[model samples]
Target: MVAAMVKSARKPARRRLSPAEKARIEEIFHRFLSEEDDPRTELNYDSPYTLVVAVALSAQATDVSVNKATARLFEVAHTPQDMLALGEEGLIPYIASIGLYRTKAKNVIAAAKIIMEQHGGEVPLDRAALQALPGVGRKTASVVLNELRIEPAIAVDTHVFRVSHRLKLAFGKTPDQVEAELMAVVPEPYLVRAHHWLILHGRYTCVARRPKCDQCLIADLCPSRGTGARVPAVPEPERHRR
Candidate 1:
């Protein structure tokens, strides 16, 4: 019983991709670039302040839903001063359609006040400064940075996280670990738009419930193609041609 208990306590070995497999992953991203040259976030914002607020409000909310609210909200409150003027009570009505509008309203108002007083009414581009805001976290900060082109980062939202595990690009249990793994493997040139491509792919194609593997461009290279045997990675020349 003691030996059995000890054996049961041992963790299973993790799968590590080889150089060829890693290159194949890079090639998959290359294919994405070939298809969509300049991928971007779906959220619409006119300025850094609005973008920051939009991303913050987007937590537990859909971009479409957020955009709907922001379309009207931004018309009235595009700047930190404008948002501050709106106040928490005033802001709630604008974002009431969102999941946690009340809490989001409070955070947005507080963050806006901070930006106004501390950052001179501008959204700070730095990650540390952005995360210091009331509602902003690692993922939100990463999104703001990536969208603004202030930095190259992979923000592991549900879409990116699911796609990463589905493609066997990273076997991390958490978003932060998956992000580090991706940054290590993803080639330099493709880093800027990689997150956008992966997010779009997961949202539309590699869906959580039932991925459309048949229509997936990199289906041949995916280890989790839902088939038992591993499919061969498509050659670079052929991949670009498609």
Candidate 2:
């Protein structure tokens, strides 16, 4: 017995950047684009359907962990039909290592059934359709669409949000606001891969605990750049490779 409130909450509109700020933002992405001509998601997937499931499972979980689990999971059930055949019980063991395996397993199973019964086993590319899936949400659908290059979207995960704020690219209190700000401010040409660039920057350079300002390509342009931050003393990549 609950009464609906007459007043509803509304999120503020995306931030508006001044001409100078806009130019700085453009320069920031220019550096990113030059460094990595084409950036892609770290999550491994063979097709759109696999990507949908991978993204769904990645909520509250790391991509590395998801990839490790999916390495074996996808071997047996890459398609919606295959996933349906696996059943929820059979699916649990493969993803048991993930953070919320039990609930994720159920959602995966339910999503599979919906995809098979409603969408003819093909993962729908439409935003509304994708979000309607059991495990799929706004951010997950955005990731799928953006990664596949079917849509230009900035899914404001933790990395993207933190990097956007750190770089002064966005001043948003929530993922939706940050996403809107990015969608509006980012140059159209780089919109598709901006999500990846921000994510990579945050994950490796502008890390949470202690950002490596020295390694950031756009440090000169970053308004939030920490002058006191020191370079991480981690070993160089491929330094000890055979």
Q: Give the number of the best model, judged by TM-score.
A: 2
Across 1-242, the per-residue lDDT of candidate 1 in tens digits comes to 32332232113233566889868988899899988998888888989888988888888778999999999999999999998888999999999999879899999999989998999998898888999999998778878887776677778777787788878777677666678788766766777788899999989998767888999999988888975433233232211000
The Cα RMSD of model 2 versus the native structure comes to 9.1
Per-residue CA lDDT of candidate 2, range 30-145, in tens?
99999998999999998999999988888878889999999999999989999999999999999999988999999999999999999998999978899899978888887898
Query: What lDDT is reached at residue 26 by model 1?
Result: 82
TM-score of structure candidate 1 = 0.86
lDDT at position 203, candidate 1: 90
TM-score of decoy 2: 0.87
Worst 10 residues of 1 by lDDT: 233-242
At residue 173, candidate 1 shows an lDDT of: 70
TM-scores for all candidates? 0.86, 0.87
Q: After superposition, how far is residue 69 of candidate 1 from its true place, in Å?
A: 0.5
